[model samples]
Target: MSGPRMTVVFATRDRATLLPRVLDRFAELQSPPGGWSLVVVDNGSRDRTVEVLRSYTDRLPLTALSCPQPGKNRALNAALQHLQGDLAVFTDDDVLPEPDWLVRLRAAADSHPEADLFGGTVLPDWPQPKPDWLCERAVEFSVLYAQQRRPSGACGFADIFGPNMAVRSAIFAAGTRFAEHVGPDDTNPLYAMGSETELLRRLEGAGHRGWFEASACVRHIIRPEQMEERWILNRAFRYGVGEGRHYAGRRSVGLLVRRLVYGIAARGSALLPPSPRRLRIRYRDRWLAGVAAGRPAARASPPSG
Candidate 1:
């Protein structure tokens, strides 16, 4: 594809003060060799987020849309409705990218015609005196946007993260649609998983490929509340359920062993010595592996003769 006309679309609920910092980062992006644009979606905030967003009308073409129904995908689909680009990059307001973030995305899009979706690393803004729990189990949530190169078989899931990922605008011609099958809310009538995770699966199911680019980067702000162990586990559990909804049907036997090991390990990490930063990596992987196995297999162990 010709170097696509691109736009960055961000979604958020609150964090009025925090959102501006990220917006500032987006505003700072330089022109790509082909050019790109930006937009934001407000997912229902009672705070001063709207007032703050209004200040941007003078600096860039930033339109703020209010979406109260919730779900990141809904906000995303709403934002998607406003853009006229060939590529629409979806990120969260909490992530601050380098000055060249958009520029790099355009470059990647320009270079790879086969790449329908793309993502990059999210370096953490670790707090001073980073809490042990954060360095331990907390990094899991913090590093949701962390960078990695995915194996070819699973590039879609490996490169997926709602806070720092992008897709071609052509895919959203229908509106800000979420899979009635998956996304962030188990309680949601439309929830089967998360937007990014489900979207990647759809792209692959539809025969498109998404990949990670080492140079496309973003830095995510780690909120203090996210530093809590309980909060981290809550996020992990939700991630587990989300992963379960997707990868759990095939690969049943392999998933069974891993889920049991992780369930015990997650419980053990909570009781025995505090979890380590390294274990944080295992948290998502374990859940995704077990989840890739699904509810039934996740509930059972591999049978031995």
Candidate 2:
């Protein structure tokens, strides 16, 4: 039997210099039996992102869309109406998929008829002469880099991340859209994270089953700037904020006390030598602070399909 058609979706912003390599990799992808198409959404980019995308129109099966909105989730929600085929694959502009990426995902979908959601492995594409701190805490900081740790097989919603995941098209056909409140928003420096995780959690809550396709993998480019300690810690804080928003209703006195304790410990760790333990503590502390802040009160109205 032929495999299901796939629609690969991703939103990019101000990555003009890096997008060409990513698109070049996409051009080399081996099409699955059911074929595939790429949808690239330019999310309010102020750089040469538009020109870069247009240059790739002839090299790949690409359809470019523009969403002047700031949030990553809002840009993705806007692409829902253009989605076609049996599966909607999500990834980022900085990721490089293997030639057989879609083939493996399609095969996994064919093998697991019961699963509606599919997650692929995400490995890091580290910069050369990696920083010592990153080398030491690479495994521990996998979550921060969107790296997948789960073994291939049945998995939970938490196992699926934005950099590499897919879901049945029918899910969107039924009116399920990403929550626009969370995710990257250039307008807000403190915007909530977990754009994809929030949606996965909701799907699981509604009884959706997920699968892990170990063979289908992508390498998420870890830019040199991301190697900086400050950038990593900022990501940690945003992650905490995302988690806090995710579990907003479950907040309690105990959680508050824990956050207080973490704050003190994080400050104390700053005086110590640079070590994995100290970095871990600082990361956790920032995250806890974000959790305490919780979700933002003013949310943009969700886009309609």
Candidate 3:
């Protein structure tokens, strides 16, 4: 089969200040054989996000959409109707793709025609100096909502990071959509993440394959506010909660109780010292708490336009 057409999709809310810079970067990106357009869904931003998007209409192949509904997944599902590409590339509103990012993705797709999913690398672009404490756990955590950094290679797992992933349009045609309740909802702290996690896992179980292309890279901008420990801890808590949602079906009430018991023990251990062990213990406790509170499975729903 030939390389399919591509359309990059991303949803944003309330970040009017940063979306313009991202669009500037998109303007610099080189397209693949069939060319690609952009679909930016504004998830009810009270700010001038739509105006900012409209301003860029003459600068790029852009479509500005307004999704007054809540949630990132809802916005994404809503934007699906507007996409006119054989492959849907997903990224964040704050990301900067390399000039050849789409070219590399096309190359990978052309080489691996049998694969239906693709993941790429996401590097961090710190706007200012990164504090040591922040860099300490950076390798383990995305810290800035960038794709999780990993070694260069191909893999079978559907662990595609939301910041840089692509899927065949056919998958959506098969009636699959991102789990409505699993992703971040405009800073709603209670929302369990992993919108792509649940969807990709579903795709993988159906025998669809995925490939990781390291060269198709993008830079995720990290602002100063995210450098604080308080912010990082909150992110960690949400990540743990997402993990709990992933394991919900496999967990029995008795098993969950046991995990919480162990988590409590870990919390006690966390107080022993200020070493790595302490950090690990604290992380474990928060993750377990998320597991206890998060829903095991996503509720199914049709995509809304």
Off by over 4 Å in 1: 1-4, 131-157, 174-176, 180-193, 248-305
* Candidate 1 clashing pairs, residues 3+ apart or interchain: 77-176, 182-192, 182-193, 183-193, 183-194, 247-292, 248-292, 248-293, 248-294
Q: Write the per-residue lDDT of candidate 1 for residues 140-206, one digit (tens) a residue.
A: 4433434343332225655666666778777778543666444543244322345576767777788
lDDT of 1: 0.64
> How does residue 193 of candidate 1 score in lDDT?
41
lDDT string, candidate 3, 1-305, tens digits: 33457889999998889988999999998878888889999999999888899999998899888889889999999888876777899998889899999999888877887889999888888878765444445235553355566654666655568888998887897788888877878657556767887888888989989888988899888878776545554565666567777876674567567666766776576457444555555555555555556654543221111
Q: Which candidate is the best by TM-score?
A: 2
Higher-ranked by lDDT: 1 or 3: 3
Model 3 spans with C-alpha error above 4 angstroms: 1-4, 136-139, 150-153, 252-278, 295-305
Give all TM-scores, in the order shown.
0.77, 0.93, 0.86
Query: Ten consecutive residues with minimal summed lDDT in candidate 1?
Result: 296-305
Candidates 2 and 3: which is better by TM-score?
2
lDDT of 2 by residue, 62-179 (tens): 9999999898888999998988898999999999999999999999988998999999989888887665556545325556688786679999998887888999999999999999
After TM-score superposition, the amount by which residue 284's alpha carbon in candidate 3 deviates from its true location, in angstroms, is: 2.6
